[model samples]
Target chain A: MSVTSLASQLQGLAPADGSYADLFSSVLPAVIDAIGEIASSLSTAHRVALAGTANTFGDDQLNVDVAAELVLRNTLAAKCPSVVTASSEEDPVEKPVHSEAAAVATRPEHCYTVAFDPLDGSSIIAPNWTVGTILGIWEGPTAVGQPAEKQIAAVLGVYGPRTTAVVAIRLPGSSKADAASSICLEIGLGQGQQASQNSEVLRSSVRLAAPPFKTRYFAPANLRAAAQDGRYMALVSNYIQQGYTLRYSGGLVPDVVHALVKGHGVYVSPVTAQSKAKLRQLFELFPIALIVECAGGLAIDPADGSRILDRVLQGTDERAGLVCGTAEDVEAVKKALLA
Target chain B: MSVTSLASQLQGLAPADGSYADLFSSVLPAVIDAIGEIASSLSTAHRVALAGTANTFGDDQLNVDVAAELVLRNTLAAKCPSVVTASSEEDPVEKPVHSEAAAVATRPEHCYTVAFDPLDGSSIIAPNWTVGTILGIWEGPTAVGQPAEKQIAAVLGVYGPRTTAVVAIRLPGSSKADAASSICLEIGLGQGQQASQNSEVLRSSVRLAAPPFKTRYFAPANLRAAAQDGRYMALVSNYIQQGYTLRYSGGLVPDVVHALVKGHGVYVSPVTAQSKAKLRQLFELFPIALIVECAGGLAIDPADGSRILDRVLQGTDERAGLVCGTAEDVEAVKKALLA
Candidate 1:
């Protein structure tokens, strides 16, 4: 069966001005290519061995994690010249990718900053469960200090039985009316194709089911926080009593992406005094928030019910709790945890 | 880059008399091939649509489930003439596959009964999460009235980011010394290969981590049972307080397979008066129990802590709860719930 290429899908979503179109066209496919390479290696290599070092977040690095970070970083630097700054969860600091002469030669509007969590579920990878890569692209030289709304596009690469991506494109400064045109698509990559062959988009235009969902699902991250926070415990108990099907895989990307794929789910990563929020804003939560919102869902800070996109980024490593997914379910989470 | 074929791996483990080896050689690859067909179709097909029919178990049947059942049943019947009886979770009844004359011509000792849950996680499939197939092969006309130990072989097909299978073989009536020779191997099927190509074994001899696991993980199936039983709730509470990582995926095969793949996990599906046991023994629990036990972990009836392998099956539709994984975690569960 004929399938739409991701490049064409991005082209179709390009604005009249075609702003950031060329950058996304070049960067998103390269990111998928990097993921395809990692997926191939994972199928053939020793994945669970320790790399004997920790990321900047102090999480011990797996060999696959370290290798994936390098593959993605190198792929972007070599293939996407428009990326001026690259921030990775493994390194946790924004590194200037473009030379000084190139930076001055290109206008700031033409440059983009890409913050990514390469291999987000390293802890769960050994079990051969699904893990993923997350990329958030911001217009300009850096993602820091800008509100998430400034992000032009985001890509979530899922490494499961198939290598697929959820790509969300929102033109910078799009009006509320244009929100309807903002596209969040799930595309398959290199499915039924050889590893050496160029990545192919096998499926396109994947979206969540329309709201007022019939079946309820929940992925409660940071369940350990329930031990300390009575409110959190009550919320979990309420979900259990209400018979919400549990789908947590101890991975941020798979848990959140499950909500998008299944059409209805609430993924709660709440923070208490003891269980501090661990998801980074620029590297993890922001990209996921944009994808969720573009898919006609909601992503908000659990602390105060504010839209996550409305928050200004403070640093690359800034962390916060998130309650995101189907609109009604997100509201239910807010009512249970806050009200 | 050369990988071993699953056929060869099974052949290598064949006893001197080749008892049940030929049957396994025929049935396992056919199952994996059927899974490959399902996996490839899932990449391109409209998967979330319903067939508008309910299985004998009263669960709504997805189109994929119906297709998968046909594919697996047909593959087994066409490829393995030794399989005299086939039972499916969707149909939930034993049906003769071979002609009466063919069955009468063949020795009863050579014939087998296969009970399987084709497409085990239909509820979780819409989200593109991992689902699987579970198969148990008994040595006679039926699996009923036989202890799980009478089962000569079992196979689990995981349809996740990849299509893979865990094949376990234990010779019927083997001595205690031969118990050490029982095999549970995880083999990748058609990975990085064409759909028409034969299944390949990317890895072999997958085993659980040696016990006394340092890190604890739990997949609490039937979490709603916690609401009805205080003991179940307390057991869950203890796991939370002790900071066991959560990895439940609301799918039996993926949850149990996660334990084997990760080397340490306890999967609990407990029955209460309100939340009665739902897992079918002949199709779901027995095959998984055999695989877990073959992998050096333990599978037990959550009610009485008896070895699941010791229980004699009374019928095809028998239901029970399971607590299987690393020995220490299983003990912890039995203690918290039964002590």
Candidate 2:
């Protein structure tokens, strides 16, 4: 059976001009190109050549991380003129929060705000574990101290056995979270689909729905070491007793994305006194929250078990713990934590 | 930098004529072809289309898994005439134990015995986690119940951010375990490096040595559920209490390979009565043991403090848990188990 191109699908599902689809069409290529370049550069020599420079996040940036961000920045600037403001994990410059309407009112050309983590799970590169790129496109500059309710689109490119893209876009006039649609597309990099190819097709995509309840779950256990009290440890122990299997790679993208893609299971980042949440609100939490919510899964806030997307960003770099998955799994986790 | 072809490397590493290197050169393409095809088919629809039919080992055979194994079989039969007998995880066939010399004596054409898990960690596919293909090449039919020390060559193709091949060859003049040399190569399938491409250049080949001790490890905690007694559970608990970050993905290939690539850390699969041992002796255990041991690591037996490669395969389908990693890590695990 012939595969359908992702661009073609976007054309069918989205409006022709200046829509979420159009924005995705422009940004995805740039992202995929960056992935292709990054994929090729994760070599031994490349690792050795990287100066141990830390990013704004304090996680040491490998040469590849900075290079990937450049590819993204350059590609977005060239291809996505609608992007009025851009932010990235590589460089955390907290630009003033200007509404897209406000920015465009002043400079009528720009239409969107973009934020990303160009190369996530960088530490797992040496082990050859799955890692990814994440992009969050907003109708305007993201609100600094508010929930991520305004996010219009989220895309994740997971590099594993194959390069794949999971994209979710909130439809116009559909403000409800469930109104968003998501698709997983195979971005066949270097496999006939050259970096210059205008359209990479969907190998296959199914509308995501939370899978039925299962005992399987994924969580990065490293946070347990940082937890001040024994509460987080006790919760994980209880989950284990309930037969939840641990599937963590210490990578935020693949671990949470696994829950979204598998349609079941929960991925947690618990907030503890000694250990604040490791996932940043702007670059990590908000984007994943939007994506997971769009997939009929819930992203819960640890503070009050509210919808995570409704929990506004405390600051550009505010941190928050997350518990996201199918309703059953999330509820079970919440129950365990409460207990 | 122009990449060298894998075949060219084989030409330089092995005898000019027919040797284990030649055998590998002949069979690797077949295996890698299977990987490229499998990589293309891990879609949501592909997973659903596969009837939940379990394979010989009772693991549900995703249609893709069977298809992948078939690709391996056909490719091997058509390309490599040197293989006397072949076995795969999809269909466990116990072939007669025959030496390479004996097979050559009988067939004159067959020179090597090959066994593989065409798709290791198929269950992890839904989650988009990294998985792999393991190939074990022996001078003769693998001994039914003998240690893996007799392996002449081992290759592991890990499908993660990029598809990579790690090949270890036992040098002819060197009988010591340290005599083996392993190289990590990039098998650029369909990405300009066609199957017909004479060389698949080494990406970055390094003579592996265990990295200095670090308190990091990967163990499939789910195995604890299958453990008959609390011994395995107790040991894992101790590691966790000691702040050893858990890094299990329920995939043996990626877990063990992670240790090899990281240069430090340990990965263990303890034998429990209920779980006899999830890792198969022939296809999974022997190949990984050979690679890890060759890379200056230790593969230990849990029952007695002996090398896993030194233990004979009890049956064609014998299963044994594995504890492999840097010598020091393995020693620590051994001491804990004994305690």
Clash totals in order: 5, 18
Worst 10 residues of 1 chain B by lDDT: B49-58
Scored against the true structure, residue B46 in model 1 reaches a CA lDDT of 33
Worst 10 residues of 1 chain A by lDDT: A49-58
Docking class of 1: acceptable
**RMSD from true fold, candidate 1:** 4.5
Q: Candidate 1's error at A61, in angstroms?
A: 2.5
- Candidate 1 local lDDT, residue B164: 68
lDDT of each: 0.74, 0.62
TM-score of model number 2: 0.82
Instruction: Provide the lowest-lDDT 10-residue window in model 2 chain B.
Output: B49-58
- Restricted to chain B, the TM-score per model reads 0.90, 0.81
